[model samples]
Target: MKNITIIGGGLVGSLLAVLLARRGHKVDVYERRDDPRKAKPWEGRSINLVVSHRGWAALRLAGLEETVRKITVPVYARMTHDPEGRTNQLAYSIDHKANWSVSRGELNNRLLDEAERVPGVTLHFGHRCEDVDLDKATCTFSRKGAEPATSTGEVVLGCDGAFSAVRLKMQFGRFNYSQEYIEHDYKEISFPAGPDGTSLMDPNCLHIWPRRYYMLMGLANGNGSFTGTLFMPHKAVPEAPDAGFDVIRTEEQADRFLRTHFPDAYALIPNMTEQYMRHPQANLVVVRCSPWVHGATAALLGDAAHAIVPFYGEGMNAGFEDCHVLCKQLDKHGDNNWGAVLETYNAERVANGHAIADLSMRNFIEMRDLVADPRFLLRKKIEGHLQAKHPDRWMPLYSQVKFTDIPYVDALREGRRHDRIMEQVLAMPGIAEKWESEEVERKALELLDKA
Candidate 1:
C-alpha cells in the first residue's frame, strides 16, 4: 500500500484520508486550522451544505453514510417566499427524493472523528503547508512556535480549498489556473427556533426569498434553528440602486430592505437587522485549474481543483465525487501505478469540473430570479408532467444533477438540450393549462428526439 499525504484536513481532506486509509494506505492529514473538534463550533465560510446523490455515494463508499445521515435533515422541496410574503412549494424531484442538508462544521467534525478511528490514519492539525516538492511528493509545513516540518509520501493529495497553498506550489511549474470572484457577497443570519425550541418555519423544505437582484435562503439546523444567508452584489447594481450590499449597509436601510423584500424572513428573524449589520460578508469565487496531477507524484482534489459558486450546492458533492472517482481509477490501474491512475483521474475530472462550475452559475440565476417567475414555475410543472408520463424518456435537469450518478459533463449536455426543448414546449399554445395533455407530451417527446 502507498503512503498518502493530504493537505487541508477540512471536509474533503478528512474524508479522503479515511477513504485512502481504508485501503490499507498509511495516510497523514495536515490541517492548517486547529482541530475543529476541540475548538468552538466551526463558523467558517459556511453557507450550510447540501449533500445530494454523489456526496452520499462517496460517504457510503467511505463507510460513514449512516453516521453522517444522522446529522442531515432531508430537504424535499423549495418553499419560495415572494416579496409580498406569499409562498409556493416546488418539489425538487417529481417523486420527492430529498437532498440532505448538513452543517459544514458538523460534517467536518464527524468525518474527522471517523478518520481518526481508522488505524492507518494520522491527523496533524496546525501544520499549515507552506511549500511542496511536487516531483518528490513532499510538503513543507509551518506550525506554531516550531521549526518547519516536512512530510513525504509516495503520493501527495491537495484537498485544501479554493485558495490552496499546494495548488500555489503546482503553479510554479506549467499549471494553468484562474480564479473568478462573483459580484455577489453573502452574510450569515441566524434564525433561532421558536420560544419552545421548535422550528418557526417548515423544517423539511429549503426556504428561499427570491428578489431577482438579490436573495435570502434558509436551511434548517439539527437543533430546530435555521442558518440563513443573504446574497447580494457587493456594489449597487446600476439598474437597481437598493439591491446590493453596498447600498444596504446601514441598519435602517437593511431593515427597510428586509421588510420590503423578504418580509417572511424578517418576521422569523427578530434580530434580522443586527444579524445583517454585524455578521461578516464573504465573497463567492469560482476557481478553475488544469492538469490537477503533478507528474504523478502529487494531485489536487476537491475545491483546490474546482471551486464553484454555491448555487447548486454541489461544491462539496462534486469534491466528494472527485475522491470516489480517484479511488475508482486506483482500483482500475492498481494502487501502485500512480502515473496511470493520476493521468486517468485528471483526464476524467477536469472537463466535468468546468461543466459543474458553469452549471452552478446557471443555477444562480434560476435560484435568484427564475424560481419566482410564473413561466419558470409553469415550465417545471410541464417538465414534471413529461417525466411522470414518460419516465424512461425524460428526467428534469435538477433530478439528473441531484438524484443520479451521471457524469456532470453528461448532465450539463443533457440539461442544455432539455432547456432548448422546454423553451419550445412552453411556447406551445395553452401550455400552462394543457401541460399534462397527450399533445404536449407528444410535442416534448418529438423535440427531445429531434434534439
Candidate 2:
C-alpha cells in the first residue's frame, strides 16, 4: 500500500482522504484548522457550495452521498431579479431541477468525519503545512505543543487551496505560475431565520439580484437561513481612496454600504453589521498554473491548481471533479505507475480548468447584465425556437454545458463555435433563411456531436 499525505482539509482534500482510504491506501490528512465538527452552533465560518453533477458524483464515489443529501437543499432553477425589481425564474433544466445548496463547513466536517472513520485514514487537525521538499518527498508541518515535524510519503497531494506551500516549494525551472486578479471584490452576509420564519427567498432556487456593477446572490442552508454574497467591481469605489464608503473596514461602514447599495436586502439580514465586521472580505481572482504535477513526489489539485472566479459556480464542482479524475486514474494504474498517471492527469485537467475559468468569467456578464436585457432574452427566445424546430441541428449551449456530463474543455470549444454560427445565422436574409441554411445546419450538428 502507498503512503499518501494530503494537505488542506477543505472539500477537496477531505474527499480525497476518504477516496484513497477506501482504496485501501494508508492516507493521512493534515488540516490547518481545528476540527469543525467539535464546534457548536456552526461557529467558525460559513461558505455555501453549489453542488451540481460534478460535486455530487464525487460525493457518491467517496461514499458520503447519503450524509450530504440529509443536509443539502436542492436548487431547481435561478430566481433572477432585474434592476427595477422584476423577478423571473430561469429553469436550469427543462423540468427545473438543477443543483444543490450546501454549507461548506457542514460538508467539510462530514467528509472529515467519514474519512476519520475509514480504517486506513488518519486525521490530523491543526497541523499546518509549513514547507515541502519534493526532491526528498518530505513535508514539514507546524502544530501546537510539538516540535516542528516532518512526514514523508510516496506521494503528497496539495489541495491546500490558492495559497499552497507545496506548490511554492515545487517551483523549479520552467514551472509557470501566474495569478490574475480580476477587478472585483466580494463580501458575504448571512440572514438567519426569524420567529417561525422559513428562508426569506425561494429555498428551491439560486436567487440572484443583479445590479449592473454589483450583484447579490443567495443560497439556501439547512437551518432555515440563507448565505448571501455581494460581488462588485472594486472600481465601483469613489475617487477618494480613504472615502469611508469604499472601504469595508468597520461595522458602521459595512452597514452604511449595505444600506445604500442593497437597500432591499439590508432589512432581511439580522446582525448584518456584526457578520460583516467579523468575517473578512474575500477577493475574486483567476489563478492559473502549468504542469500541476512534479514527478511522482507531488501534485496539486483543487484551488491550489486553478482558482477560478465564482461567477459560474464551478469552483468547488471543478475541484470535486479533480478528485474524481485523479481517483479514476489511480485505480486504472493500480497504484503502481504513479509517474505516468500523474503526468496524464495533469495534462488532461489543466485544459479543462482553463476552459472553466474563462467560461466562469464570461458568465458574470450574463448574470449581472444580460439577465435583465430584453435583447439578450429575445435572442434566447429565438434560439430556443430554432432549437425546438430543428432538434438535431440546433441546441442552446447553456443546456449542453450545465445539464450534461460533457467534458468542460469540449463544452467551451463548442460554445465558441456556436457563437460564431449564431453571428452568421443572425446575418442571414431572414429568420426563414436562418433556419433553412443547410451549411449552418451541418455545422450545428457537428458542434452537437462535439458537445
Candidate 3:
C-alpha cells in the first residue's frame, strides 16, 4: 500500500482520504480550518451544496450514498421569480429526477466523521499547508499555536482549494496557470421558516429571481429554512444601470433595491436589509492549470485543478468525480504503479477541467439572462420535449452533466451540438406553439441526423 498525503481536508480532500484509506493506503488529511464538527460552521450560515449524479457516484463508490442522502433535501425543479412577483417552474428532468441539497459545512463534517472511522485515515485540523517538496512528496504545515510540522509520503495529493498552498509549491516548477475573477460578487440572505417549521416556499424546488443582469437564488434546508443569495456585478457598467453592488451601498438603497426588483423575496425575508448588510459580499473566481501532477510524486485534485463558477453547481461533483476516476485508475494499473496512474489521470482530467470551467460560465449567462427570456424558455421546453420523446437520440446538456456520468468534455461537446440542433428547430415557424408536436420532433431528429 502507498503512503498518501491529501491537503485541504475540504469536501473533496476528505472524501479522497476515505477512498484511499479503505484501499489499504496510509492516508493523512490536513485542514487549515478548525474541525467543523466541533466548530459547527453550518449553524449560522452556509451555502447549500447540490449533490448530483457525479457526486453520488463518488459517494456510492465510498459506500456513503445512503448515509449522505439523509441530510439532503431533493430539488427536482427550479422556481423562477419574475420582476412583477410572477413565477415559472422549470423541471430539471422531464421525469422529475432530483439533485440533492445539503449544507456545505454539514457535508464536510459528515465526511470527516466517516473519514475518521477508517482504520488507516488520520485527520490533522488547523494545520495549514505552508510548503511542499514536490519531488520528495513532503509537505510543511503551520499549526495555529504549535511549531510547524512536516510530513512525507510516497504521494502528495493537492486537494487544497483554488488558493492552494500545495498548488503554490507546484507553481515553483514548470506549470501553466491562470486565475480569472468574474465581475460578479454575492452576499447571503437568510430566509427564516414559518412558526411551525414549514417552508414558506416550495422546498422541493430551487428558487431563482433572474433580473437579466443580476440574480438571486435560494436553496432549502431540511429544517424548513432557506439560504438566499444575491449575485450582482461588483461595479455597474453603462449597459446595466441597476445591476451592481456599487449601486446599493447604503442600507436605504439596499432596502429600496431589494423591495423594487424582488418584492416577493423582500416580503419573505423580513429582515432582508439587516442580513444584506451583515454578510460580506464574496467574489467569484475561476482557476485553470495544466499538468495537475509532478512526476507521480505529487498531484492536484478538485479546485486545485479547476475552480469554476458556481452557476452550474457541479464544482463539488466534478471534484468527487476526480476521486472516483483516480480510484479507478489505481484499480486498473494496481496500487504500486503510481507513474502510469498519475499520467493517465492528468491526461484525462485536464481537458475536462477546462471544459467545465467554460460550461459553468455559459450556465451563468443562461441563469442570469436567458432563463427570464420568453424565447429561451421556449427553447428549454423544446429541448425537454425532444428528450422525452427521443430519449436515446436526444439528451439535454443539463441532463448529461447533472443526471448522467458523462465526462464534462463529452458533455460540453454534446451540449454544443444540442445548441446547433435547437437553433434550427426553434427557427421553424410556430415553433413556440408546436414544440410538443410530432412535426417539431421530426424536424429536430432530421437536423440531428444531418449534424
* C-alpha lDDT of residue 409 in model 1: 93
The candidate, 2 or 3, that scores higher on lDDT is 3
Residue 116's lDDT in candidate 3: 98
Error of 3 at 115 (Å): 0.5
Tell me which residue pairs clash in candidate 3: none
Candidate 3 lDDT over residue span 347-426, tens digit each: 88999999999999999999999988999999988888788788988889999999998889999998999888888888
Off by over 4 Å in 3: 40-45
Return the TM-score for each candidate structure: 0.98, 0.88, 0.98
lDDT tens digits by residue: candidate 2, 303-323: 998999888878888898899
Q: What TM-score does model 1 achieve against the real structure? A: 0.98
Candidate number that wins on TM-score, 1 or 2: 1
| Tens-digit per-residue lDDT, 1-451, candidate 1 | 8989999998899999999999889999999989988987635245588899999999999999999999999999999998889889999988979999899988999999999999999999999999988888998999998888999898899999999998999898898999999999999988889988899999899999988888899999888899998889999788879888878879999999888888888888888998888888899999999989987799999999999999999999999999999999989998889899999999999999999999999999999999999999999998888898889989888899889989999999999999999899889988778888899888989999999
Better of 2 and 3 by TM-score: 3
